[model samples]
Target: MRQEDIWDADTAARYDTPGTGMFAPDVVGPAVDRLAALAGGGRALEFAIGTGRVAVPLAARGVPVTGIELSQAMLQRLREKADEAAIPVVVGDMATATAPGEYTLVYLVYNTISNLLTQAEQVACFRNAARHLAPGGRFVIELEVPDLRRLPPGQPAVVFAAEPGYLGVDTFDVLQQHLVSHHFTFDPLITGDRQARVGRSPHRYIWPAELDLMGQLAGFDLESRHADWRGTEFTADSPGHVSVYRTAGKPVSSGP
Candidate 1:
């Protein structure tokens, strides 16, 4: 499937449906709250803000939010949600999109950075976030910790059974730093009723140290890194990585 297919209107509609929106309140909401506190009461920008999942709630908390999204379909749903919640958004690619003004907080949550799929693109995303931040502003990122250890010896696929006759299979190509997932549904009685839907979401998993290096390269200081929204210690076994970086101040270069 093409990369653009992932953000089609059908997919956007499915995003908020039951079982699909499972991680929204539990994982995304708290993280937005944390980032809002770090913003110090100024405007905020969200990169790849699909469907306004976190952005709408953040705006509800009185933190002004502006979003940059790549897909018009996804942005349509975001605008629908924003209309319901009375928020505003911008449409563009997160890696290079620029907001109207500097923000105290800039964030990309839920592994959205992985959508970039390459080292160069992810680095450029970091630089873009740095450019949008006001002096001393913070850029927050939330992503799942890469689980390389899950891959079995001499095998490339890991199966996660979501329910009976439903499986989420992940294929990892370590050499290329890419991963693809297939969602399969099977018929209990007639095997021919089975169907497979493939989602080719490529990602370049970076370790926490690598992310820190990227932040430094973008002229930001690593202020804090947490394991989860509650601010737990970050370790190798942590399920998620939450990082906060402060933009370097005066005499330091700021880009357009």
Candidate 2:
């Protein structure tokens, strides 16, 4: 399926929960703080900057921010929060789209890179980030470590999250390095019935080592990797990681 169809208007409309989930202050604050520091008074480019979640806050924190997003629905939501002057965005696939100017920091947060769904595309994304960065600039990615360990011997599915109103399951196609996340949200109806809303999106899960190789091919060197946006040490047992890659050699100009 096309990526845009997956993140349609309905999904964009309910994407942000101001003070909860991924939008929680504690969740967003550290990320903004880290990205802002990475920007170091220079510009930042965010891949798949949905609803201005990080870009808006990062921009407000005095960091110049630009975005490349494939979903017009998502970009529309971001536009509602900030005008073009505040945060300019290019509407196209993050893997190939070019946003003018070199950036000190390029970031893809919240496992958004996995949305590429193919090794080639994921590799191209790293190259794209490199193309937009200034010398010594860093490209940061927030991604989940594959949860194959949680899947039983022959099982292809695992439950990643189970909360009051939400249930998230990931089914893997190990052969293809592909996985589809299924989300089911329960809402209570006035008639004492619970309405269920379901959504699914495909992703290509990449091992840290594999991701490092991709970065290397894109002329990047792994600088640091942490458990989360807080900069905690990453361990084998960690469920996810935030990796930083510094570009090697000179920057590749992204023409206007």
Candidate 3:
């Protein structure tokens, strides 16, 4: 199925887990804090701003926010939280679509950029973010560093999350830098039976150095990188990173 189909209405309807999971205040609060600070009192733009997860709260912090999203279903979910005046969104591919007005901050969180699934598209995404950003503006991305080290020799899969009734695993193809995240949920039915649901999404994993090269190609300077939203130190041992890039000039196809 197409990536759009994978994030259909049904998926959007069940995407939020209020007060828990990704929606937990601890998770969302720090992210909003960091993004708001990066916005520096100027307008902000979110790429793949699904369901107003961070936008709504960031707006509550007084930043003018706009969004570009591919999934209409997810946009609908965002509308339920904030109207067009509060958070206007353009429906199209974030790598190519343009939203009105310049922004001091352009952000893609939760590893959404990986959803583009290819190197060219991901590079385009950085360029697009640069396009929307004002001079001196910043582009931030929260992404996991590929977890290939966690996989046992000759093994392609690694378990990342295991909760009471949910499991998250990632299978990798190092040759292609391809990853498919598999989610399995077990829910107890009214009849005391457990129902199982499975989901899989493909992503192209980029390493830190490769991400920096993409930024350079798009005329951005790597400003700072942290291990988390709280501004923890980033190290080789870190599982993920929050990278901040400042726009410097027009993108270039070839290095100088």
Candidate 4:
């Protein structure tokens, strides 16, 4: 089945785990603030802007925002929150979709780049972001580095989360550089708890340096990379990075 189909209406309706996980106010605030500052009074575009988790608030902050999303169900949820005029969106692949205007900022958050599933596709996504960028505009990405270091040799999978009625795990295909994440959530014990809910998403994991090369191939220069939206320094131990790449010209302002 197509990956987009996995996010059907049933899944999209509950996609927002607000005030928890990535949707928490503390998490969303810093990312929007950083993105807004980088936009510098110019427009911003989002790739796979799922459920307007970041777009709506960023738009509320007065920056024009547009999006390209593959899942119609996800787009429906976004539209329910904000009118089309407030946050215009294109319904298509992020690697190939086009909105009507050039933008100062284009970003993919929550490691969404991995959803492309191939090196060439990921590179195409970079070129696509560059395509929408005005000269001197910036492209930003929030991505998690592969957690292979923690995977014991000969082990093909790792469990990252385990709690009351919830479990999350990732299985790796080392030869193909692919990973599939499995999420399982069970109903409360009081509800008989027989029917379990589950979902899986596959991705092509990539390295930070590899992405820099992709950026270069797409006419962007590496500008900044931080461990988080709060500007923490990235290190060998950092599990993720928020990277900014700029078109080969002076931007309206220094992008974070």
lDDT of 1 by residue, 177-204 (tens): 7777676656645456545544445567
| Candidate 4 deviant stretches above 4 angstroms | 189-192, 254-256
lDDT of 3 by residue, 165-191 (tens): 789999989998998999988877521
Rank all candidate structures by their TM-score, best first, as comma-separated numbers.
4, 2, 3, 1
- Using all chains and alpha carbons, the TM-scores for the candidates as numbered come to 0.88, 0.94, 0.94, 0.96
For candidate 1, give the lDDT of residue 8: 88
| Range of the 10 consecutive residues with the lowest summed lDDT in candidate 2 | 247-256
Clashing pairs in 1: none
Q: Which pairs of residues collide in model 4?
A: none
Which is the leading candidate under lDDT?
4
Put down candidate 4 lDDT per residue, 1-256, tens digits, no spaces. Answer: 5768888898898788878987999999999999999998999999999899999999999999999999999999999899899999999999989888889999999999999988999999999999998889999999998899978899999998999888999999989889999988887663355876788889899999999999999999998999999999999999999999999766666644
> Which 10 residues in a row give candidate 1 its minimum summed lDDT?
247-256
Deviation from native of the Cα of residue 84 in model 1, angstroms: 11
Candidate achieving higher TM-score, 1 or 2: 2
- Show where candidate 1 strays beyond 4 Å: 18-24, 84-86, 185-192, 250-256
- Predictions in order: lDDT: 0.77, 0.90, 0.90, 0.92
Better of 1 and 4 by lDDT: 4
lDDT score for residue 169 of model 3: 96
